[model samples]
Target: MHISEGVLAAPVLISGVAAAAAGCSVGLRKMDFDKTPRVAVMASTFFVASLIHVPIGPSSIHLILTGLVGIILGWASFPAILVALLLQSILFQFGGLTTLGVNCFAMAFPALLCYLIFSKLINGKNQSLAVIAGFLAGFCGVMLAVIIIAAALAISGEQFITVARLILIAHLPVMIIEGLIVTTIVVFLRRAKPELLKGVV
Candidate 1:
């Protein structure tokens, strides 16, 4: 989900920028040169996945795949998501430059959180547990992102409260779809490329 330009107050925007900067700093520091190509691929995936979005009030509904990205890239999801959002803004105008930090933080923070919560389980020996963790990571990524976005909108103005509620309602299907998609992908990667899940963070 992307919050359009001029919708947030100055304080929120500044806080977003600061938070994004901190995340990117840590992400860059932890980035592995050997995995640079993987990061680029995930960034491209995020860029393409979010391009087809349905407008809903100030934000939009779309596939983010942030959980998969986070599980694969760990802390690097922040800069990867930032790059994708930047390209989306410049090339398609899906989101504005002014709101880049907020959008990036909204999507990437949940990604980081998912990685922290589920990465170990996904890497564990039990395939069933890994699948469940994958689903939960995917489901929670969207859920948490929605909450963060709703909070941002609500904090901005009372007028946006209804829209925030509508956004949450509209994204229920997306959350489930993401969960299934992530589960399948996690299974495939585990079978074909288990190394990808190890020591990513």
Candidate 2:
């Protein structure tokens, strides 16, 4: 979900920028140089996945795949998302440059949160638990992003309250779809490339 420019108040925008900067700093520090190519691939995936979106007031409905990125890239999702969003803003203008920080934080923070909450279970020996964790991660990722976007809208002004609610309602189906998609990916990775899940965070 990308918050359009001018929708958020100045204070909200400033706070978003500060928070995103902090996250990017941490992500950069934790990033593995050797895995740069993998990070690029994930960024490209994120970029492509969100290309098609249905505009809803200040935000939009789209398949973010933040959970998948988080599970594979961990904290690195901050920079990856930032890069993708930056490109989208520059190229397609899906989101404005002024709103990049808020949009990036809204999407990437949930990803980082999901990674922190489910990474261990996803890497655990119990395959069933891992699968469950994967589903939850994907489900929660979209849910959390919706919450953040709603909050940002509400905080901006009372006019956005209705739009905020609509955004939440519109994304329910997306959550389930994302959950299933992530589950399938997790299963495949566990069987074909277990190493991708380990030592990521």
Candidate 3:
């Protein structure tokens, strides 16, 4: 769920923005030329994957495929997410311009984590393990994003407990769906396009 600009307080938003900037910087600096194609795939996947919106309770949520992004792009997922988020803000108004950094951070942190985890697994010969790793990474990424969003709201407005709770509850199902799809996608890609994940290690 995209947080409206007015929903979060200044301190939380500012902190999120700072973190987002750092993440983007690091992700961009670490991008390798050999991995450019993979990162581009990640950027496109993130942009397209997020289009499958589903309404759980009060808010609408969508699949992020961030774990997939991480597994493919590694640390570069941060810049890729920033790109996708920037476009979303301009085109769909999914997130506001002022909050773009925060929104990017919320989505990108889990992606970074996923990249770390998937990097290790892909180094192994067992394809199944890699797929499983991808699933877990995706699940964690979704959960962490939810937590980040809640934390930002809580920090911004002390009275946002109900809002956070509602968002968490609504996103639970979406997370599960995302997890399943992520796992399946990872396996499919592993079989169909192993080269895409070649340099993630």
Candidate 4:
């Protein structure tokens, strides 16, 4: 799920880095230091979530839980994802430091968007829509990330288009799997732990 170094050209990497810095700054200001405990819990969730994988064709897929992270933590997701990805990169080499910013934007931006979109869904007296939106958020989120990666790869080298094609093809089943998992989780949470959605539990 992480984009490695040398996969993107210098320009893309630089632009992603700048966007990451801006995102982190905005996310930081919105972070509530007083609720460090919740942040810690979500950080742990985000950390452990990536370890559980589902096989999808040649490449395996993992549960990013970006939707869950966003629903619970809001804008604080930026640092949470940053910390988790850094740990993964250092400990497991799931991604590299050189491509960290691009990967960060790939994952964290969707998380932020999930927060915005889901909040409206849940508050509008449409539980089903909220669940569906949460599901689609996770589904669409990965595609968006893949698109970014593919575009970055395309610009990196003309030879990379085949790799991009493989990526786009490989992720279709993963997207479906993500949608199912995300929907199931959201529905379960809505019925069993509604407080979590309201940002209280």
How high is the lDDT of residue 53 in model 3? Answer: 80
The sequence of per-residue lDDT tens digits that candidate 3 reaches over residues 1-201 is 467877777787888889988988888778777767767865786688778886666877667776667777767777787888778878887778778777888888887787776767854678778777767877877888888888888787769988888988877786787777877777776778777765442
How well is each residue in 136-164 modelled by candidate 4, as lDDT tens digits?
Answer: 86777677778877877888889999998
Clash statistics: count for each candidate: 0, 0, 0, 0
Q: What is the alpha-carbon lDDT for the whole of candidate 4? A: 0.76
Cα deviation of 107 in candidate 3 (Å)?
0.5
Lowest lDDT 10-residue stretch of candidate 4: 192-201
TM-score of every model versus the real structure: 0.91, 0.91, 0.87, 0.89
Give the per-residue lDDT digits (tens) of candidate 1, residues 137-187.
Answer: 899999898988998999999999999999998888788888988888899
Which regions of candidate 3 fall more than 4 Å away from where they truly are?
32-38, 53-61, 199-201
Q: Candidate 2 lDDT, tens digit per residue, 32-138?
A: 78777878886786677776574556876667787878888898999888998888878887888778888889988999998899999998999999999999999
lDDT of 4 at 61: 71
Candidate 3 weakest ten by summed lDDT: 192-201
Pairs clashing within candidate 1 = none
lDDT of 2: 0.86
